[model samples]
Target: MAEKASIKCPSCGTEVEKPKKTWPLIGRPARDGSRIKLMIGQFECPRCGRKFKVAVKKERIPPEGR
Candidate 1:
């Protein structure tokens, strides 16, 4: 199973799920469109309604066949 990723609310230290929205901060998609190379995420803390940003990068493991 793929591991789930999460970030903490910098203000409150509460664990939060993936950001509600994301914008490409840098990099571009591979020629094959397999993934987004990099991005910046905007997250809102459900507990305090605080907003924050985080840098995100996509990575994957090669298949066993490789």
Candidate 2:
């Protein structure tokens, strides 16, 4: 199973749902040269009307039932 990602609004402390759109980060080199990638998501707070960007690291994990 995949874990659900969530973020809290800094202005109002309200929990915001995961972003509907996500874009992969490119052209960045890792120190260890790992195959991991970073994803950036933009979201706006419904209550406070504030916009922010959230960075999420992408990784591969085995399924829970395995």
Candidate 3:
């Protein structure tokens, strides 16, 4: 059984299924287009047959008591 997940895309705001095996995915959209290559698994969007990258933004910790 696959675990249910809810996540939002930083760009395009496209809603997609978050598969359990895709939890550790690492990908980035192609600079020229929407061609995406994932490090965890393979997937493609059904809309335009383009893949969306799993871009992760690290939260910076502000200096405490500065």
- Give every collision pair in model 1: none
- Writing each residue's lDDT as its tens digit, candidate 2 over 1-66 gives 987776888789888886656798654445544445568887788889888888755763333342
Task: Estimate the Cα RMSD of every predicted model relative to the unseen true structure.
Answer: 6.4, 6.5, 11.9
Predictions in order: lDDT: 0.73, 0.70, 0.42
Q: Which structure among the candidates has the greatest TM-score?
A: 2
Instruction: Write the residue-wise lDDT of candidate 1 on 1-66 in tens digits.
Output: 976667899999998787999987544445554444456789999999899988765554233342
**Candidate 2 TM-score, C-alpha based:** 0.66
Best by lDDT: 1
| lDDT of model 2, residue 36 | 50
Worst 10-residue lDDT window for candidate 2 reads 57-66
State TM-scores per candidate: 0.61, 0.66, 0.27
Backbone collisions counted per model: 0, 0, 0
lDDT of 3 by residue, 22-55 (tens): 4344345445434333334333444444465553
Judged by lDDT against the true structure, how good is candidate 1? 0.73
Models ranked on TM-score: 2, 1, 3
Clashing pairs in 3: none
